[model samples]
Target: MALAATVAGAPVHAQDSDWLSYRDAYRGMVAFEKYGKPKQFLQQHYQVGARDGSPLPVDFRLALSGKTMQLNLPLDAVGRAVFPLLKAAYDENAVLTVNRKLGAYVFRPRISIVVRPDGVYEGAELRAACEQALDFQRTVNAAGYRDKHCVGVRFTFAKKPDADVRWKGGAPLPAVPGPAFPDEAGNAYSVVTVRFDAATDKGQVVSQNAPLAVSPVFE
Candidate 1:
């Protein structure tokens, strides 16, 4: 599988059962959900295009503060890495717009993480990696998302290897790379499987998803 090419530490074949669960769990979490009300400061629509104006699929990473959420849409691979950082920064400056009449804040925190080239691979490790990345992005951004005084709170993504990597409590194939393709939306994406480790944060890292939008895409 494509994930094997990305995992650098272990041999491809190691565990089995564990990898299977990982694959099943990962696939179960791909649907999109509405988060909350939108903000006026964020862009209404993000334009995701390649350097040459080619339409690229956009994957998003999100971070949330008390009532504010930050959305990031990376236009390229390099931008993908920096997208989380940008969300962190934006969440820092977001102010709560309160509504006296409603006795509540006018803005509701919400974010959506999407990727182009959907279903590039089918396995446990890739799903775990995506979840981990999302969790980290959300937690780190939370520092800025919430009030400046917010403290003593910690966030982390769960660490679990893909099913192909573990079976019957034994490690299976290290990780395999999978086919590359674009989703019906016409965007390219790739999936890689990797073992999950709380230490060094290595094992499985896949190609970044398309740009993600944290806007109130819903009403």
Candidate 2:
């Protein structure tokens, strides 16, 4: 008799736990506490363009339970190196899935912003201008994002726009802030808001999220 090697179901190459933790693939500066491992992976594979220091906060889910990613890189040998680190990040018995198109996993719906310029548009007028754009009919399809129509609203201005603008915007835009806008002084930059679990497919004003202002004082 000859012994044969075989898998029980469809030659399963990998296994993942029944429950996978949800993750957001943010484009902007995200806190390393909840997404520590994923950030580490991005830092290690710096070429992936995941951490380009862009103001546009993109969001998506990680292949693993918000910790690691698995890939069967037959053609891309370099990708294989990232596996061990990703695998170890999760639990010993925690099942993981192999995501081939890891890049696609990151979805940037659209970086819609109120171009509140740096010059005269610094304060109230900036907010007024942003209001026009926000009030416009630019729809954002948040299918790729876990939260439907949850937007990472960015208010571009040399100075803070009316805080009231943070609570404004439509269903598709979800003009919600990422975090609380800091009162710290520096060169002008955009304010990003973190909006979670918005229940609309279009930009609906989510007034709850606070804004986080990012000032770039490049030396």
Candidate 3:
């Protein structure tokens, strides 16, 4: 509960100018499609535990910019969250006793990219960057065990190319429609992609490769 309470107080980082439009597009997508309701009980009340029957309480926060979703979890809190979740999912009387061992909870988020304008997009680069960030967080948390605090977090993105090229000064870009992804409970999430074009001084479209689609990955 403290974790959830603290999340609202967490300072959000300044969003990138180039990526701001994408964020709006993502919001629009959520509005048009029904992603259903989030598992408020699980997120707010569940506690992770270890096989030894030790309890873990992890605090988590999330943010989206461009095609990336950054997940922040305090080290101690993450350790707490993972253990309990694992305990509930696994058998307590099993010979292996998988829950006894302590390990890092790695969060790797990914996005599907669709480019409509037909240009070479650095999909691999984006994927790699997200993976690296997730890996690094795992490492940091592991190393900080001496302090009894480890923050296990993940960053992932799904990218899609946008074809909507109309953008007037101070106006939001148009939204592109798309299918929805269902969660563990079979609820659908409506995802939309919004594209912005880089233009020259004379208003000539320079590149369609600008960053597209920004929204909460797990909302």
Task: Find the candidate with the highest TM-score and give its number.
Answer: 2
What does the lDDT read for residue 139 in candidate 1? 46
| lDDT string, candidate 2, 103-205, tens digits | 2221211212222223112223323333322222122212322232213324322224433343234332223323212222222343434232333223233
Query: Candidate 1 residues 1-219, lDDT tens each?
Result: 112211101112212221111221112111111223322122211121232222332342222222345333233331122212233334344321111211110111122233325413222333333343334324435443233221110111111132122222334433222211111122222222333334313232232222222111110
Clashes of each: 46, 23, 18
Query: What is the C-alpha lDDT profile of model 3 across 1-219, one tens digit per residue?
Result: 001111110111222221112222222222212323321111111122232322232223222221222322232221211112222112222111112122321111222222224422233333333333333323333342223321211111122333323222324233333322111111111233222223222232112443332212221
TM-score of every candidate: 0.18, 0.20, 0.19
* Full-model lDDT for every candidate: 0.24, 0.25, 0.24
Residue 115 C-alpha lDDT in model 2: 28
Model 2 local distance difference test score: 0.25
Cα deviation at 196, candidate 2, in Å, is: 22
Q: Candidate 3, which segments miss by more than 4 Å at Cα?
A: 1-120, 140-186, 191-219
